[model samples]
Target: MKTNFLFTMLTGLLLFTACSEKPATTYTINGTIPDNSLDGKMIYIYNRDNNNLNIDSTVVTGTTFTFTGKMDTAAYCRIDASREYYVNFILENGTINLDLSKPVSPSGSPLNDEIARFFAAQDSMSDLIDSKRQEFMKQTEDKEERMKLQKDFFQNEWKPAYLAMLDGFFDRNLNNPIGGMALNYMDGYLSTDQIKAKLSLLSEPVRNTPSMQERLQRFDALEKTAEGKPFTDFTIETEDGNKVSLSDYVGKGKYTLVDFWASWCGPCRAETPVLAEVYNQYKNKGLEVLGVAVWDSPENTKKAIEELKITWPQILNAGEKPTKLYGINGIPHIILFGPDGTIIARDLRGDGLKAKVKEVIETK
Candidate 1:
């Protein structure tokens, strides 16, 4: 009886252990290059879904490098080298060896060719922008014309090429590994308006995907913030603990210049004298200026305020919370609020700020 009981206990323990254990899943990649210089170079492996887990280059030894990591299943993987070489591979639970000497394409699909073409086009567009910039600087004496040319290069040449690349990738394979990575890259650079324009070009099926849906939502939120329609009732505390709000300043029907800046920002510092002059001139004529300083320590900000002789109510030490609330990412950001607490203009600087302020107050 005792022997039987011991046997039963051992069997149960073994069964539990077997049920709980998970199989080790790893991918091993090895490569050899003809050039001895390729040895000791770094190779990077990127996971498509979790971008934060994107691993850096694995050191190459004798023109060979091996990467070991547990993947959930056979998913998309990108192998990058010195010349920006990319290949998509299905990483199974076993060891997979890759030889650079042998031609091994990503996923053995024609879409890789399409991606390569798109990258070539991207390079071409970058070259075009550089060339246009040089020409604009040489031929144009007007600063406005040069700025317009720069904007057009990005809006027309650069942006259209990027959109074309995305459309081409999706057309080839909706679930392409490279396509997903390209989409993430686009999200980083493109503005809200540019993204919306690109999304309008995508097919219905691609638009309906969960990833695309989330991106669209982000674009919408950003667009709304950029419009500055929601920054009403702007308020902050002064360094002396005095509670100041836009409502109190603009209460008696006065135009307010809600300036967003910081002491550490060089551009903001440069613009301070101009702002002070404008404020001094317009303060008696129903103009109120409020400087909202972000991302600065209180002591440093106080010193700057004294040095710049800023007499207006300055809000210091709001950190990033208020800045994000107002959707302000850049320093030297200025917003013109009408008497009714509605945002009339945004990011006005130097002559632009002066022009807008004069136009609004004079018209009123």
Candidate 2:
């Protein structure tokens, strides 16, 4: 009878202990924005999957708001109050107090000191690039010399420092909220080879996150596409309703540049003249250029073509057809195809474009 009682008591104790263990850590957020106008604004905390925790404005009698939620783990959370204001915080199982008395700066949260340092380093680099630009403008009359100088600066000085900063930031805090922003910036500014080299340094955990995995896939696709590999192609209708297939242009037995741009894009406009010059110089040497204008109105596109005096074959009014085909997220994207319809180079700009074209033409 005593043994039975003891067994029952032990089972009850274990059940009670299991039930009493703390629930997953929930962060209680208190935000105090001194300004009365901001009282009733909606705040959101987002993760990589666009999954977000939303908090409605607290009662405006006092300029303070509260939000409570559980984070599955230690991860980066983006705190946003509409499009104008945003701050990123590293959220764990603790109370988070946000004092938004001052406007959130583009430099990001001052609470994370390392993030501040990263921003400062980026600012310094921008200043250095500006100084270099001024120096180059002062000394160079020859276009080739200026191009060489710019290339050298990017490859040797700027790239190395940028990479070092990226490495340092990751080393300090692999889960830094600014890491995503930095990776995005690097994706745009660095070549596939450079990005690949840097990505090899990241820890497996960091590389395996959903966001990082997407970036890795993009980089892989870019590298494969740039190396003259087979890629999916599509057709789009021009303003005149003429179907233009990427395959149709490949029969010319020459290297082709498939350019993605838009009439409304300022960068595309600036690049038009450069492209025209390159096209005129190399047209006789078996180089063909095809422009694909995305998200452009027919009238605006016609005006741009007329203003630019572009004679190359172009396809506009394609809506999102070409964008989806190329997996294009950003504008001024270029993909070069060799004679056999295999993609050769991608995202080439300015002198890099010229150099790649020259190399391909010379080999042929």
Candidate 3:
């Protein structure tokens, strides 16, 4: 995005004298369509939030098109030329200059600039994997050979490099809106400690933002159960009004697998059969599987278990205590506990659960 001629002149004069600190207060997007291919295309600026489409649009009249609007806050906007592909830009109150035939990086909005940097980082990440995959493909005609090459590259190299890049980016940009935006993207990629450490590095202004604060709270919840930490204890009521504590189920002289799930959760439901198989195979092998149903009624929990034929011991109507204790924000938060009651691993599912159970219980 490019600043208006008047605004740019005023900004330059202000910066020259170091006298004014006012900001640009409107948004302008200038586009160069460049060919008859898109001359009749109806371009749209889509706002992802509120499920809004074409909050603004322009029909290409010739080789160029432009859009101008007022905005109180900066957000990500998609320039949709067609369904298959689109360009993303930060919608800020400033002029954004673009040549559709060239790169989509816009200049005026600082938020947009930061967003562009983050995206470039992402593209670089993808490019590295693509390069490795292509190199492997060129050397091998076997389908399985190419598959292993791609898998090895991603699992061994992509994650560590991408995580290190993210760590540096998050560390460097923790004082602003960009830092706030980056937190949501850290899920599943950063470890519990990495998330906590990086989040703490964020400046107060960014950390104080409501969303950031909420994310911090969530990180707080999960970090308490970090792998290798002792599992916190909690109790739940059974259908017969008996209070069954976690100590009764876990922390025994066996590896305990706590399956935090809900009856309505589809993924959790799908994982029941896997749980059943693992439980059947390992129940007597110093491995115990415990089900804790949360956010679902005792009736439904019982019904689902019966229908699914899950014979494992379950704590119904477990509610939020287990989640809060475990710092779990999502369902199917499986935690593997050592016999001494320390948390061994978390978020494992399906084959991961079975493999981990075998690795720990059988291999020992």
Candidate 4:
């Protein structure tokens, strides 16, 4: 009778353990699009926190589509039918119901619900401003008048409301995937210092994301060479196999205009004539224009110089060395350095370049 009791106790313990075991975590995404235009479109899911990697895709049949998968951790993901129509949501281990017809309407997950509301508020602001712009465009045939109306609306209404929404969203969601996504959006609108300030407010889990790490590195590079900071010098090998350093021209005596460009870049080529014009106007005074050819071969650089009539001194075959040092992601990044090598202005383009050179030189 005692042996039977022991057996019964062991069986009871096994049953309890089996009941307490946790189930495998997974996610289900049930999406519907009422837009007939997107009935046969292919929908894609990208892991935004993971360098925008395309992790899953499916074709829409009729009015609905579904995606199911498991992830060890929740990530910020985006669903796109096309570039113009996309929605961002937290991909957690739960069922998510999404309506792709609207800007943001994901539901059924805690984080996704919050993200949806946040983006909905943002869409309202965008829609209102768009409506105002459309009305003004209809009223005015003059380009300048239309531009003025849009600019005034942006400064008075749109920017302040947008910033407030962004601030509130970041504050409320700093510890979640929503905060990570917000930081990515802030990249274009905020300065490096501003982004760093926001970064400090984020929780460790959010800050540790891949996109955040890349932003941190970019901010570091930008800060090291920001305006009013002294120039960071780099050496380049010329076409004649001679070495030239940026220190050779900058910080000597005259104000220097540095152009970081590539031979294959259309905008870079387009801006060369403007640079030449600026050089002619200011070289006799206290200005020097130096061209640093990046991400191009010596042959192409030389051919471009001859074809474009670029008379300025050039450092060829610089590759990506200079671009990395200055945090330059795109070519044709122009910088104006003070007489003492401090960066006076950056990203100068078109008539603004000429005006800035004029202002500084005339002041000198």
Give the clashing residue pairs of candidate 1, or none: none
lDDT of each: 0.63, 0.65, 0.73, 0.81
Off by over 4 Å in 1: 1-67, 71-124, 136-230, 233-252, 306-309
Supply candidate 3's per-residue lDDT for 243. 96
Off by over 4 Å in 4: 1-24, 30-46, 53-69, 78-89, 97-108, 116-123, 141-145, 187-192, 236-245, 262-270, 293-309, 313-323, 328-332
For model 2, residues 60-138, the per-residue Cα lDDT tens digits are 3356777666655445556665454456555544466565543322221222334445555666667767888778888
* Model 2 misplaced stretches (Cα beyond 4 Å): 1-24, 48-62, 82-84, 99-117, 124-159, 175-208, 237-244, 281-285, 295-303, 317-330, 351-364
Name every residue pair that clashes in candidate 2.
none
Q: After superposition, how far is residue 306 of candidate 2 from its true place, in Å?
A: 4.3
* Global CA lDDT computed for model 2: 0.65
lDDT of 4 by residue, 149-189 (tens): 88887776566556656666777778878876666666667
Give, for candidate 2, the lowest lDDT window spanning 10 residues. Answer: 10-19
Candidates 1 and 2 compared by lDDT, better number:
2
RMSD versus native structure for model 1 = 16.7
In candidate 1, what are the lDDT values of residues 215-253, reduced to their tens digit? 666555445645446444545676677876656654357
Clashes of each: 0, 0, 7, 0
lDDT of 3 by residue, 95-187 (tens): 786656544465556666666667666666677667777899898999998898777766666665665555555655565555655665677
Q: What is the lDDT of residue 92 in candidate 3?
A: 71
